[model samples]
Target: MNPKWLTRAGLCALLAIISLAASAAPAGPPRVAVTDLAYEERVSEYFRVVSASSKSSLRASGRESERDSDDAYSRRSSGSLNARSESNYSSTEGTYSYIDRGEMRKFTADIKGGLIKSGRFELVQGKPFTDTKHTEKLYDIIARIKQGMYPGADYVLFGSINSIEFRQEANPIDHTNTVSHTLSLELVGEFSLINTRNYAIKSSFSAMGTGQDVKLLTSQGGRVVLNRGKVVSEVSRSLGEDVARQVEEQLTGVSSAEERDNSYRPRGESVREEVIIFK
Candidate 1:
């Protein structure tokens, strides 16, 4: 073979190898960042009323006549009766505060870390971006991602705590006269995933969770308050895990191959969870 021909063949072989390698290698995961989570604690009020009433009455009348001579004897009797009823009503009004911005920030951070640990996507960890102004800044978020503010983030995840409600009430424990109560925290959040390159929303979803700390008050005046933050943290972690799975499913059109084997978990008691995907 001519030396020139050998050179051409060598170049062709190198180009072919490069093409094959590029084709065989899997595409890298999208660069993702979690922005600050926002929540506004608005005052909430609730009112309730209960009422009951009862009444009863009885009356009797009788008449008799006797004949023996003209209009001799006659007897008559009559009675009047009256009844009254009384009603009692009880009304209760309560005012309370929801989770504040700082708490929500913590919750968001936990979620960000959880997603990274889920092994579903590559998440870029950085300072969370919070929306202070009332105006929308979703586009601004994408711009920041494009500017490499989040350090090579191609996709951005943003969320807001839509609402938070706290309820405290008493209940009987295990058929005993002893009373128990629970302070419950319910949170609803809206999350969005954006593609920085095209500004396209890859997914938008809503998730809700509730965390309750129970207190049992015995007849002996003994009481115990379960740590509130513990349940809240568990709930936040659960929400984060679910969101990661949702994003993975939406992006790849399938569930993540990696199995989530977290041994310790909560029962998600009284938590209403929902997810809607918009591609």
Candidate 2:
């Protein structure tokens, strides 16, 4: 065989193998967009209350009467004197009250801050749906985008705070006015993934997270107390992250399944065999 012919044949075979490999290559990662989480209908401002106990004591009651002898000092200036009387009374009572921890505290938390572009998908920050009536805006935004847009979002994720609970418990440790209290905050959220084109929900799930703060109350000053507002924000952010993470995991799993399916296809086999032959 002519050496030049062999060289040409080898080049043609290599090109064909390269084309086959390209055809079998997995698709690029999907684009995902996240909307600003919506607040539930019954949502209200967050708050906390502080309370302490004290003792009250009252002195005993007393009555006294006094009379003076008129003739005892009758030498120089004898004068009539009226009798005098005095009375004292005392009473005690104990009461407990819940004082509102009255400093208006504020905190800002972004639940989706932990999400970033990562393996198998590109995360995109979309216009947040902050209003109660945000569905119209979201659908309109999706409608404006052209189909098959390169690197365009294939799915949209929506999340909302489903529940928020705040509670405080106080326990007295001993008689010396020593007390301990625990503050708990729980947040629950629901998340949904929708197909961008048809607006059909592909997946839905719920996640929850909790945060707690504890303090010991004492007559001794300078004991640190946890801020209730901060704890609520922290717990809310935690719950949001949990929900977002589950969505990411689901999307990643779907991508992996697709890759697995592709690997078992005949094109995949052809690519593998050609690469091995070339090697």
Query: Distance from true position, residue 146, model 2, in Å?
Result: 9.0
- Tens-digit per-residue lDDT, 1-279, candidate 1: 699999999999999999999999998756688876665465566756566665555554555555566757655555565655555656666666643343245566566666665555577875554545523443356655755667677778877778767777888878786888788777778888887778789998887766777777878876676677877876677677666667766665665354333321222324457999999
> Candidate 2 lDDT, tens digit per residue, 82-141?
444455555544544432211111111344444441233456645433333433443343
**Cα lDDT of all candidates, in order?**
0.68, 0.58
Clashing pairs in model 2, backbone N/Cα/C closer than 3 A = none
For candidate 2, what is the lDDT? Answer: 0.58
Error of 2 at 179 (Å): 1.9
Stretches off by above 4 angstroms in model 1 are: 41-103, 130-139, 173-175, 252-279
Residue 6, candidate 2: alpha-carbon lDDT = 98
In angstroms, give how far residue 8 of model 2 lies from its true place.
14
